[model samples]
Every structure is written in structure tokens, then in C-alpha cells.
Target: MKKKLVMMLLAACVMVAGCGKTAVSDNFQNSDAKEQEEFQIEVESKIEQEKCFLCGDAEDSLMGYYSKKESIGIVHLNSLYVSETRVRDFDDDGNELFQQGGSSTMVNSFGEGYGSVAIHGNPDRGYTNIDVSVSDKDEVDFELLEDRLCQICLDTLADFYEDQINSGDNENNGCSGYCLIDFQTKELHRLSEPYSGYTMGDYYVKYDIWKEGGGSDWHRISVFIAYLPERVASGN
Candidate 1:
């Protein structure tokens, strides 16, 4: 797959143990050994002009890579290791229910914001098929998230096409991708492969919003994005 090949190349270039990297750099071609560690471009912050993708913890190895103030809507995993999981359905009072009908520890979530992000298996395939999620938060706007995902899909598709044209590869055989979750509709929406957004799913861009998790706060709005590896590795 294009994403896999790109990631392999990236790993070779950076000498990282795994295939995880952040998207702070404006373009991929400019990433160098030193720039990858120190951060590339300086993205402007939304809450305050001073806030930035690089404004967060500096010591956190992966989280600090391309992450700034917070993980996108989904919490960022500190490492690139895929979490262990089990997705099996059983009967409840003689009625069979989807294993995902309820939450499980297998979500493979990382950090916390309004909610954390998780990925489970598909209703059909066991571990092979996966879906991502954002744990329940006091406040969430499904409509807004849906809209933003649509826009991101379009942007990603555009990038894919541009890359294809530039590379003169008309064939798209290896770029199988994942779909985004629509909290409003409670359904899966196909996300264009290699979303234009950050690869780690740990940065909260403009489309992502989070409420403080302090004393008393209600109106939960946490989103769990299913599917990884695919989301992280774009075919570009």
C-alpha cells in the first residue's frame, strides 16, 4: 500500500522503531532528522493567538512530536503500539447483542479530553475489521463533527488525486482506507484515504473542540474514531 510504503520509508529516514509520525510539518518532503524532533512548521493556535500545535508538553516522546495543546478530538496515544483487543457478541437475557453494544476495555484508548478515542473490530470480521470511537463526554456535537469529517474527507481526496497525478500513477489498487464515524447518525461514513488532517489523530484542529475536565462540567461531546494504521498512514 502507498501509505505503508511511505511509512516504511519514513521509518527508515527517521530511524523510529515504529510507523507513527505527526503532521506538524507543512509538507512531507521537508521533514529531516532534526526538524522531525524539534518540530517543523509553526501552526497558529485558535483559542489564543499564542496557542500552537507545538505549545504542549515537550518531553512527551510521541505525544509531543506533532501534538500541541491537545489531541485532535481523539486522545493521542503515547506510543505507536496497536492495543490488544477482543470483539465478540453474546446473548443478554436470551437476546443476542452486538459486542460493541456496550463499552469494553479493549477500546485501546490513550489520553483524556472531553472524551478519549477508541477502536474496536467490525461487526463482521473479528480483529481484522476495526472501527474507531470517542468515549462519551458531557458535551458533544454530532452535527458539527460530521460536517468537519466531510470537509476533511474532501481535502484528503483532493490530496490523494494531486499526489497521484504528480506521481503519474493512475492505479489506486493498494490504498484501502477506513471510514469516519458519524455520531449524529450513529453510522460509518467513508473517509477518503489519507485524510488531510494530522496523521496521529491526536491534535485538535479547528474542527476539534474540547471542554475543560475539572470540577463540574456537563454537556458531554466526546468522539471515538475507529480504525488506525490506515488513518495514520496515507497513501501519499
Candidate 2:
């Protein structure tokens, strides 16, 4: 009789221990689910706040690049429909110096102003130089010029990348490229390959403003945006 009583006690203890473990596990799972729910709510709130200034109608709108400035409205990015002008270099003796290249100009209309990007390239030196300039009809300020120039460069680069992806000629072979933009300093940098030292995911815009003259009414801005990918850059 004593042996049976001891056996019953042992069984009861085992059952209690098993139940304790299950209860602990359930508590842990509930805690995890609550944390996840909180995180999801936070993310949704952020997206909702961002929707205020975001452009939802345009297909080419750069929704990823957000600006909180009051002056900036819903920004759009579009492909360049540049007009090509043939350019040929000649020595003093009228001899061609390099292979025939062309200069292309793409002008975009901005708020109360206009911005243009001129690309000069040769077969030997593909896209040797890119000049970004902006001006306003009435009066242009540093803020307007800087913003317009950066936007133009971003649109151009994004258009180029889209072309490469659509052509199935991307040499990166599914590798991704990122652009870093800094509106404060007016710098734009591109990371063509993975792990290029600089943190990925931001496009920087860097440029110098050279006022034609102290009394000049218009602003002539120069933009420098890094283009590192050889395939898309060289038109290969």
C-alpha cells in the first residue's frame, strides 16, 4: 500500500511539472506575439505619416526619396528625351582628333524655372562629361537651383538604370546599385557594386554654384553625379 501511494505522488509531481513547462511556453509565445503586433502598428503609423507629402498618382514618382521641406511638392522622375547634337574635335589643321561623338541636352521644366542636363560623350570616352544647369525666368535662388539640379540628376540616373534592366544587358547579373543623395551639401554619389565602403541606400548631391556675375539675374548651377556602372554608362 505504501508503494502504491508513493507511485501516485510521483505521477502527480510529473503532471504538475509538465503543466508548468507548458504554461511558461504559452506565456512566452503570447509575449512574442504582442511585441510583433506593436512593431507592425508602429510601421503602419510611419507609412501613414509619410503619405501626406508623397505623390501617389504619378507612376515615375520617386516615392522612396522623401523631402519634408515646405517648398518641395510631390516630385516626379522621368526619362530624358534629349536632343542630340553631333560634335567633332579637330586640330589646327582640320583633322579629326577623336571618333565622332555627340552632345545631348535634356531640359526639364521645374517650378517657375527650368533645368537642363547636357551629356557630352565620344566613342573612345563614353559620357566623358555631364553638365547640369538650372535657371529661373524671374529670379533664381540657391535653394531652387540646388533642388532642381539634384532632381534632374536623379531622374537621369534612374532612367538609365531602367533601360539597362529592360534590355536584359545588365552586367551586374541581378546585382543592385544604390544612389546616395545629400541635398544639404549638394552632392550625389553612386555605388555600383556591393560593399563599396560607403553605406548603401542614399543618394548624395554635390555641386558648386558659379554665379555668372554678382548682378546676374539667372543662376547657372553645375551638378556632379557619380556614374560608376560601365555597362549602362558606356551604352554597351
Candidate 3:
């Protein structure tokens, strides 16, 4: 089951690429101590520029546990919802035509943050694809920040997914559809969209389904977990 999940995720990563959208790349795999330090400095500097972007919605509601000082950004993994499952088609010769099945759930956040998840198909063929993304309504070049932050964000997400799968919490889980992450409230808005409203303090990190395919790209998984330095000392 564990191996199955990994394959599904890796497949999704490839689909994300074919859609003309690029996943953020990192140098953690081959970086030496000096190179690692340089990467850290670059990450930290970007975090400093817009600390609030990485933070949850703290100004809107005061009832939940929100923190802008403890993290530079939060990562959220959306769940996948499969409408068809356990259905297979094949020719008389047993050549499989198509099969439908999926079980990918949303992983809890590592910190206070918010966003959605997306998936294209069932897990039977291991065609689940998920992309964790972000957007700044302020029209700022936040994609650059996303590129630098994805390394840590994916690390956080992989830990959550691995933990869930190992614990058997992933049984019958399908890809999470569009949803919202209220890290401030520690809540997930499933099968929903962001309400109409724009504020400078509002931020978003979206993880959606790019497409479906089998791609053996383990580099995007936990490979960077060991390279992740501590969270930013303080938010900007």
C-alpha cells in the first residue's frame, strides 16, 4: 500500500509538468555545506520579504490559533475525490481497457496556512496527481517565493501523507477536490472555493491535480526533508 501511494504521487508530479506548469526545483540533493548555507540564506531572505504570505489568516478571526511568527509559510495537501471506483473494463482476451479506483486523502498542515487540493482520476491505475501551489491576489511576484518555498512545503506535506498512509488512515481515501485551508482556524474547507473578498492580508497556497500518469520522480518527495532548515526565526 505504501509503495502504491508513492507511485501515485510520483505519477501526479509528472502530470503537473505536462500541463505546462513547472514544479519548484531545489539543490538539496547535491548541495555541500556551503551550498546548503547559500540556499538557506536565499530561502530566508525571500521569507523575510513577505512573512505574512507564509502565515495564516490572523487578522480576520481571533478565536483560532494563528501564528505569523513561527513560520515563513504553511503547506496544505488537498484531498482527492473519486466518483468511480472498483470498476474495470477489459476485452475478451483480458487486455484491460480501463479501471477506476482511487484513495488519496488530504494531509494535515505542518503549520498555520491555507489552500486547496486537486486530482484528475482514480488510483487503480495510479493516475492521481496533486500540485501544491500559491497565489498572491496583490499581483506580486509570489511565484518566485513559491519556487523557493516549495522545497520546505513539500517536505512538510510528504511527512503528513506518509504518516497517514502508515497509520491506515488512508483506506478508501480518494483525491481531494477543490478546498480551502484555514490554518488560523485549523480547519479545512472541502469541496469549496475561496469566498469573494480581497484583502492585503489574505494569502493562499493551492495544491491541485495537474493530470494523471506514471512518472518515477522521487526527488519531489521526502528527498528534501533532511535539507530543510528550521522554520524562519520570525515572520516579517
TM-score of 3: 0.19
Model 2 — which ten-residue stretch has the worst lDDT?
36-45
lDDT for 139 in candidate 2 is 23
Candidate 1: residue 8 Cα off by (Å): 28
Model 2, global lDDT: 0.31
For residues 1-236, what per-residue lDDT tens digits would candidate 2 score against the true structure? 00011112223333434464455554554444421111000001122222321222123333323222111111212221222111223333434355544444444443344444454433233222334443433221223222223343434334434433444533431111223333222233332222223421222223344445677544443433332333444556
TM-scores of all predicted structures: 0.19, 0.27, 0.19
Off by over 4 Å in 1: 1-153, 173-199, 202-236
Could you give the candidate ranking by lDDT, starting with the highest?
Answer: 2, 1, 3
- Count of clashes in candidate 2: 17
- Candidate 3 CA-lDDT value: 0.27
In model 3, state the lDDT of residue 141.
22
**After aligning candidate 3 to the native by TM-score, how far in Å is the CA of 32 from where it should be?**
41
